[model samples]
Target: MVKGIPVSFGVGIARAVCLSAKETQAVHVDSQPANVEQELKKLHDSIERSTAELNRLHEQVSQEIGAAEAAILDAHLAFLQDPAFAGEMKTQIQEQQLYAVQAVQQVMEHFAAIFESLDDSYMRERAADVRDVGKRMIKNINNPEGDAQEAYTEPFVLVAEDVTPSDTISLPRQLVRAIVAAKGGATSHAAILARSLGIPAVMGAGPELLTQTANGDLVIVDGTSGSIHINPDEETLARYQKQAERERAEMEQLEKLRDLPAQTTDGRRIELVANIGRPEETEAVLAKGAEGVGLFRSEFLFMDREQLPTEEEQFAAYRDAISGMAGKPVIIRTLDVGGDKHLPYLDMPKEENPFLGWRAIRISLDRIDLFKEQLRAILRASAFGKALIMFPMISHVEQIRRAKGLVEEVKQELRQEGIAFDEAIPLGIMIEIPAACLIADALAAEVDFFSIGTNDLVQYTLAVDRMNERLSDLYSYFHPAVLRLIQQVIDASHRNGIWTGMCGEMAADPLAAPLLLGMGLDEFSCNANSLPRVKEQIRRMSYESAQEVAKNALALSTPDEVKTYLASL
Candidate 1:
């Protein structure tokens, strides 16, 4: 009767059949000729194919916090390519005469031990990455021809202690109605992808779920509320089934709003856009009435999969985004990987201040190979549709200049190769850092648009880490300084005849909507589900009136006052 923290909500009862990573028999491969590289090659080939399949699933369906997924593939790629790591395994295989799968499993467990031994919470999280790859490798070897599946699709929910990228990929999207697991954080990979795909899921269910239910039992999953009900009585089941029908009916009604212009009750037009990660997310935008893609995170293309996505792969991804937008503007942000975001292949040392380290444009400018590859891909994809490039974490004028130079260099190469591209793609910068926010006027003059990323903006402005739940309350977007900086960037972008947008959580708030509208933000982007509610609020107030509301908002001393005054308007 031990209760565990419920990270996700939904009650599902399934039979107790836990699939754990298995160990292998010994093989003495060290005694074989040191040149038995063919065996290592075979292992690499299997992992590579598995990686390809995993990446394909990522492209087709959404999982939770998929950013961590790239970390999983990256760790596997690292393990596969690591001469020392693979060398030790092969040596053990020869010396001990072990089974191929078992030998590979043991070596992976060894690396998992290292990550588990780390003291830092962030680094310690890497243990999951190690185990994910390890299990995937064993799965590949054990059932080399196909996934070890007892079912394909049954419209049933999967309840597990945990779920992985491999597990999600192996499931048929149509058959699986929802997913519930007992472990994983809010930003866990399972949760993030579920949000992307619009699947109803709940994770971290713990023992109460496993101990209470059996497999093949009917259940209800309330993703919106994170609740699970098992074997509902006839009346209860009928009620929930009715609720589900109503929800579907309501969603069908919203579909009619897709192409219609977003106008407030007062007749003020508000731009409604989608926050997308890859080109795949563009379809949802078009389906949900998005005028365009407001935030196209390029990080998805750069990370996650084993191989560095080639220019063609990136170009295809970008091309798909542009074509899907159907002439609507796609504002693409160049790689924003840093701090909590990592590429295992990069070999970046553990840093004390990852937030301030080689990240975003800083890393791009320094790593010409990585940066140029991405820029070329975007430029090539630009020919397919309207495309704009935005640089992230631009704290200094010099950084922007350096990044621009690389873009120019890429343009030159395209010219040399006689490849066509949008020669006049609009360039933008994310004014996220305080230094960038304060100096927005200069940055605005140098770029075509400015997007205020309040997630990092609030964190950087307040000197508080948003991930630190202990100080989460202290992470305020309503701080006077933060508002001032937002205004500064907005004012600067407007002064330069460029439009401004805020893609952070602040952009979606009903209270802050009036303030941002007053500050002259030309566009607002947020979660697709939030678009209607925010648009509804905007339609209630005139553009001129929102300006007045924002003016009064600046004088407020507390977050509550800001909220009250805005609502009063």
Candidate 2:
């Protein structure tokens, strides 16, 4: 009778001790004046004790959600120490005739408002963290009973209207069997964290979930299937328990293969690269045997928060990511935010079709100062590791030329400052737009590499939005035009002595593996988890066989022919 998204599979018979993040605290403030400073001190001391714990939470989450996201609290540590933010709070209470607690509350909400309105989910989550720290501080001031972080002690499932990144920090990990939420789709940070932690989670159950389930009731969750069951009987519970154990075992078996090489039977090799958001993610890539980072989306540095991150903040992130790779290649893609990937700092107007609106390099060029600051950060970080500078959504030769000019300008400035950098760092462009693919040969001569963004390429080529499940079937990476465009890019890159790689979902598909192998792609960078299976397929065939299949397939006109060829293989 309960409704909620079921993120994980399996059933366990246990008493429910529900821990909901949306539950608010009354946050009593002591009335004594000079005595209140003593209480405020007690609260500050509580915050001080919790700081170390909060940081540990940050690292635990970093392990699950990438280091960059984990570092959100890292900046908060600095804010806690900030004379400006702290001084304003004290000033509001002492000089403006506001209560000490109200002063902190107002200060926090002021900052929280800036983040909550931002277009970036990463940034929006920070508002929740600010709220978290603020409320914790208030609880500390009040010396509330049984509020010692671990209020939830028994094994149970956590259901919430929504789960913010901060909600996971101290959520009684030992007690939480799985996560179920009424909101959040796949791209939400909550879903991403659940996936990383291998936790069963269901999201987007809607308002119906509010009343269906209650505390102290047995429930079943199937994360893999996204199903939830209320008051599942003994037989059902036993069956789901088996399913949970089996799936957990399978996941463990996969983890062991994390660092193994991804090579095909015939000796064709493909790169297993991690898609990351920050410099800290390099550690995960290295642990997973990622040849390198294929996509380092830099938008997190720009989106979700009030103002753009300082150059030093951005530089540290970039430097850490590259350094974490330990001399392995790190392809850094600059701000790919706008449209659906919106950043609040830019104040971009709402559009009917954000996908077709100003995004990626289009926004970068429009705000040259922000663009140049990023270039400087990349160049500065280049001294720390093997960093490749890449531009996204490039559609014209002039755009490439102008971007190169900015890079040159940044390099010149660095040279004047005597900073070390890979001035010869490879510059690559994403072949996503239809125009860029059509002019592949011309573009090939200008850039160091070409990475097929098949997600966008297929969307653009087929005139379908891949995000729209209704139009998903129409989104074919094997369309004749898509194949011919890929061929053009590959042939042109080979001709120009530049490398061509595929970083899109297509690169991970076993069926597309041989076709790409034959077409002569220099690198096949894909999700780190898919490496072995794709490698096994590549090992089964030779370069010549893949080439022939690719040739024959390209000559065919339909997606069915291409799929048939792959299936026959």
| Number of the predicted model whose lDDT against the real structure is largest | 2
User: Which regions of candidate 1 are displaced past 4 Å?
Assistant: 1-87, 99-105, 119-122, 140-146, 230-243, 275-288, 298-326, 335-337, 340-350, 365-385, 397-425, 434-446, 458-498, 504-521, 526-569
State, as a TM-score between 0 and 1, how close model 2 is to the true structure: 0.65
Residue 3 of model 2, lDDT score: 47
Candidate with the greatest TM-score versus the true structure: 1
How high is the lDDT of residue 503 in model 2?
82
Q: In model 2, which runs have C-alpha deviations exceeding 4 angstroms?
A: 1-16, 21-23, 27-56, 71-155, 172-175, 233-239, 265-267, 277-281, 297-327, 334-386, 405-424, 431-442, 452-569
lDDT of 1: 0.71
lDDT of 2 at 213: 73
TM-score of 1: 0.71
Q: After superposition, how far is residue 402 of candidate 2 from its true place, in Å?
A: 2.2
For residues 295-343, could you state the per-residue lDDT of candidate 1 as single tens digits?
8888877675555788888889889999989899898898888777787
lDDT of each: 0.71, 0.72
